[model samples]
Target: MRLILESKFQSLLLNWYSKNARILPWRSKPSLYKTVVSEFMLQQTQVKTMLPYFERWMRLFPSFEALSEANESNVLTAWAGLGYYARAKCLHECARGFVKNPVNSYRQWLNCKGIGDYTAAAIASIAFDEAVAVVDGNVIRVLCRLLSITESFKTKEVALKIIRPIANQFLSKTNPGKYNEALMELGAIVCTKQKPRCEVCPVKSCCKSYQKDTVHLCPHFFQVKRTCCTMQRYWIRDTHAFLLEPSTVGKVFRNTLQGLLELPIMTPQRMSVVGLGKLIFTGKRSIGPKDFIEQIYSPQKQVNSQSLMSLPEFSNCVRVPFDQRQRLACTGPHKRWISKLLQ
Candidate 1:
């Protein structure tokens, strides 16, 4: 990478970004707190989907001090609708850590709970004006096309050794914050994955993949087959309240959903003994590489809720009355299910 080319790329990118950058809420008045919250919420979530949640979160938590002082349950509740609950937990942890011992550098931020290399770089550069490059999915795609590198980014070594070095080389030292954002913005709106807007791309002449006409094939990726899964949940209700339980899905859910409630899961053994009851709600949800067919059931016979309470399964459950459902912190899916059931 020559200094002249780097300078040209930076000049082009910064100019394009200044004219076309999306007016995100955090971009208007960026602070360390806003940057951290937005980065955490944007992980594995699209800008459109996360916008509402981000606004709501800012109202609820406001600042690092507010978020750190909030209870774990409140934090989880505020983050309910967004799946990947782990990110919420990590953000909460980061807030607590920041409140305890504030950090300004990428290296220092990396020591926090969920601040990975990319997140640390983004926060440090965007909020603190550090001369570091951020290599998110969009940036990776842009880099691959710009340089015509066909190495699979699925491989960790390729991303770190090949992709990251190029990203660093292209980083604008004079104004790294704007430059990094410009590169990411370019990848997002113009250098898209499916059909890149090569004609209108600011740096199209400098892009090797465009010059070679290998734009689509430059960034190679391994395809992953998604698995299908079926799960059952019970919606047992008494006159006053509905019976719910803590999530028992897996270690990740248990950790993220520590203080939240969810509909009771119907395991194979439990289904065998208690039956699936009457199917009320059937829906499809996707999480990561797994597609889940979720079914909600009620008891076949009108068994008294109190009588079922004697059962060992109900011992660990909590009853949420219709009036108080709004106050309780339920999982995102379960919250929707319960709302539909009531309607």
Candidate 2:
């Protein structure tokens, strides 16, 4: 396999990035706060999906001071439909920590809430102009294919050990920020997993996988085991619908449905008011939307507001008027269900 020389690789990658860099809000007028927030939102999320959310967030809370002063409910509401609720929680904490004493270095960011190595390196290089490498999925794919590292990326620690040094070597010493972004952009747009655009790729001559006719097999992937369970949900309404507050103990749906009201669907021993009323709604929500039957239930017996406050789980329940359901914070899945219910 013909190896890509460091100097030649850096020059071509940077030239390619100069012409093909994505015109993103965070990348356009770059700021420390914006970069940090964008990095957090972009984690496990696509750039296209995060664009509108990023614009909304910047408008809502433009700075560390604004974000730190805001409450968790407001934060989660602004971050709703983003899926990863823990990022909202951690970002809130990070804002608070950053406001107390600003972080300019990667090490300082590491100590802060939810900021991992990749984020730290990205923020440090992009915002602060520090000479460091950022290794994300895009970067990993690019490096693995360029050097032909046909190893599983599921084991993160072991994979990083292989890609990190190569990234450091090819990293632009003077323009590390642009270099990193360029690598990610190349991987995202050109070196795609399904069919790479080798003809248009700037570094195609240096890609070992392209030469070996094994680009598809370069970045090895692990098949994830998915377990699907059958859940029966019951709906109760008084003046409004019934939903539970986010809790750590005895909850199956994690932050996916945080700060929203959902049916009291539990595994076994969760404090729920399912059998308190007649079984008004009966339907099944499969793993996918290929076949879905919608059944709306209007409970005959009005839920007593008095009994809701009696239980620990029901204590956080608030009677959100049907008209004001939009004011409440709900996660993605339950939010869609509620939207469908309201419609």
Candidate 3:
């Protein structure tokens, strides 16, 4: 029964994919380099969100050799607004690795830095047709709903043990690449997390959850508590230049080799000297599990660079001219604030 059902599912998925797949840049022309770039950009990002970044990145660093030759600052600048700066750094290192030694298999890709199991499987299966199943979020959700696996995947071990075997079983032997893409596409557009279009789902009849009328409660997982924090940043400016601190210098920005600079955080000592300027920008942003309420203030009186630079808080800060700030690599929010301030 399982084998018969799997065969039916595969046919339905691949047939739907052939006609309804979105026309993405990477999909339009399937190449090893393009697949690598798209997978990296899509790590924690959606297709719509990463489309512009992918296009710009391809224009900036077209090939693996080109990306390998590019500097970290340039890479970070190109990936500035993408949020997860670490992915950019990993892609840079991966490019260099690919340039030196290109490998197509899943195991070989796993040996490369920052290429985890999912990424390795994706690249291997999608680019090389290696018959490996990719059990990403989309796949997991799809399978869980189809099989009515309601186990809480609070740990990686649990998820791998539960979902992986099923994914491999369902993966097509003749064309694993297209089959995997089709399953992911179904999850993305049809069997979505919220309002799933079950009526239009090609494999709706084969889905156990749909048959049982438990599609809404099919895929369940433990919820995580988000940490909320407030951040106060300063936008101190002199006549020609503004004080910006290197992201590498701060603890908050230590998540990655963020080669960008950000607006200085107003420490108590620094705040005592340079009073809070006019309120320039205030917004809330979430990265991973932490939610940040960020506020940027500009001082009313402009202090000289020498005095500001003498403070411990601004010791490593650089004075970037307003005109030249555009060229400098900066955190996403700071970059937008700087551009908006200029306008």
Best by TM-score: 3
- Model 2 CA lDDT for position 148: 83
The parts of candidate 2 lying over 4 Å away from their true place are 1-4, 152-154, 239-241, 247-261, 266-313
| Worst-scoring 10-residue span by lDDT in model 1 | 249-258
User: All candidates' lDDT scores?
Assistant: 0.82, 0.73, 0.85
Candidate 2: TM-score? 0.85
Model 3 clashes, total count: 2
- Pairing residues by index, what is the TM-score of model 3? 0.93
**How displaced is residue 242 in candidate 2, in Å?**
3.9
Candidate 1 lDDT: 0.82
Supply every candidate's count of residue pairs whose N, Cα or C atoms clash at under 3 angstroms. Answer: 0, 1, 2
Instruction: Predict model 3's lDDT versus the native.
Output: 0.85
Say what the RMSD of model 1 is.
Answer: 2.3
Off by over 4 Å in 1: 153-161, 252-259, 268-274, 304-310
In model 3, the Cα lDDT at residue 285 comes to 71
Give the per-residue lDDT digits (tens) of candidate 3, residues 1-343: 9999999999999999999999999998789999999988888889999999899999999999999999988998898877677888889999998898888899999988778888998899999999999887778889988988876778555777789989999999999999988988998999998999999899998998899888888677778789988888887877788888866333564565356688887788778888777788887777667788888888766688767787776788898887887677787867888887667
> How does model 1 score by TM-score?
0.91
